[model samples]
Target: MLTLYVDAAREPNTGLSAAGAVLIHQKAQQQFKSPVFQSLDNHAAEFQGLIWALEQLTDHQDILTVYSDSKLLIEALHKHYAKHYQDQVDRILFLLASHRLVFSQWLPEKDNLGAHNLALQALKNRQTND
Candidate 1:
């Protein structure tokens, strides 16, 4: 089984946002993180992070569980309802249904430390590269 934790952040006064995700396969004790530029709202970024994480999975047959701190995103996914960002929402939902993915809500930033730090580091790296 593979479990993933995801988070996203948007810079204040800037449209720029980044999404980050960390996947841990407990049985194998392996982990991975991905941080990418997301030219969208925080909600979109969160959903995108989940999608990105799912895309990284090596085995589609593995039991997949996704964790995120965004309640809105969790609720949306749980309800199978579409949000304003129809494209992103549709994409994520399609992936979830296709893979038979499981969704869970995680609160308290401490629990999502790795993904959060990766996102901030990605922002720093982007700035440095520019």
Candidate 2:
């Protein structure tokens, strides 16, 4: 089973945002973090992390389980429960259906520190580079 942990971060003053993900697949692990273009809000940034993680999979039969700290992202994906970012929510659901998406759990923020830190780092990097 492939397990992915995803998170997002934003700079309040600059409105800069980043998405991060840690993927555990087979015996290997992959990490990704990047600044989001167009400076999306927290919800869109967080959902983009999951979308980016899902896009990393090349196999259609791969079983994927996702862990996130964002309740909005989880509920949006699982329950179709987002009013504003319905497009992102629908896109994530489509990706989930393409893969063997089994579990989408909401973990405590502390439990998702790896991805969280990565997101912060990405945001910082974007600031520094710009």
Model 1 ranges off by over 4 Å: 27-35
TM-score of each: 0.83, 0.90
* Tens digit per residue, CA lDDT, model 1, 1-130: 7787778766655655666667777655444445546555777777777777667677676677777788877777777775576677677777766555565675777888878877777666666766
Candidate-wise lDDT, in order: 0.70, 0.81
Q: Please give the RMSD to the true structure for each candidate, in Å.
A: 2.2, 1.6
Q: What is candidate 2's TM-score against the reference?
A: 0.90
